[model samples]
Target: MRVEYDDVETEDDLRVTYQGDLFTGEVVERSPQGQVIAITTYFNGMEDGLSTEFYPSGERKAEGSARYGTAVGVHQEWHRNGNLAARLEFDDQGKLLSRHRWAEDGTPIESFVAES
Candidate 1:
């Protein structure tokens, strides 16, 4: 994946720099503090492959995959403390298939399945 930097505006009042494109490469976003906050991949200008995000403290917050700009497959989330948060599964059409949640302490919370 190509890596470059460009200034970008954000609603959180922090300047971000985007590295890479939404096609055949991975885009990495860096916070104004120079911390890598997110990394997403793209295929032919659409979101594809693995996507990941991290807390400002460098802890992973979320991880998932996208297919042609839509969320698909199994996705996972976590708390900044490295605790399990949620897990979701989706179909190729971006339809939710199943979902499960857990507390930061690893306590099971709830689970659900998609209709149809």
Candidate 2:
């Protein structure tokens, strides 16, 4: 999950530098004005890697990881104020194993997976 490079076009018709990390290939979908609209990444065609999505204003929308194409790792989503909206977990096959959600003030609203 390393970002080789991005093919984003700048206002001057130049290629913008795409900065990426090793664990996940941080990809940013930009608008026509070179503003980051969405950020997404993948592993094996599914969201089984790392992804950090942002709002139009460059605020983090969601962030998480996956295994074998399943959400099987630490997943954290944030509100506009950067408060964790939800914390979730999954299995290797993308089955929901557990989840813990919160409001803007951090009230623990919880859930779990009951699969054999």
Candidate 3:
């Protein structure tokens, strides 16, 4: 079920309750002009699955996945002009695996891989 961000009550941390019950589904946050600014997925009141944030102009700003509130897999961010800004990888257990970043002009800024 999808719900407006204002309609949900935030509990501790990433937990949210909708209509007095733990929310399990998508919560959408909108700009004042009604443009979708963010979409977050929840499971049993905790952040899980994919969550995405968008620029006011509707370009994707960032995207990532989580399992029971712990970030996992690849998370990415982009500049408003459509260039990749950052990329991070995490193991299934939420351990950081790698990180890369680029400037808005697409120049490499940083790159690091966790030592095995």
Error of 3 at 57 (Å): 0.8
List clash counts for every candidate, in order. 0, 0, 0
lDDT of 1: 0.77
Worst 10 residues of 3 by lDDT: 10-19
TM for every model, in the order presented, reads: 0.78, 0.61, 0.97
Residue-level lDDT of model 2, residues 5-115, one tens digit each, is 254222232222333212334455675667776655643333345767776678888877765345666788888888889888766676777787888887777666666
Candidate 1 on 11-74: residue-level lDDT in tens? 2322223433224666688888989889877666666789999998999999999987789999
- Residue 44 shift from truth in candidate 2, angstroms: 5.2
lDDT tens digits, residue span 48-92, model 3: 999999998999999999999899999999999999999999999
RMSD for each of the candidates: 5.1, 8.0, 0.9
lDDT winner: 3
Which pairs of residues collide in model 3?
none
Tell me which of candidates 1 and 2 scores higher on TM-score: 1
Q: What ranges in model 1 sit over 4 Å off?
A: 4-22
Each model's lDDT:
0.77, 0.61, 0.97
What clash count does candidate 1 reach? 0
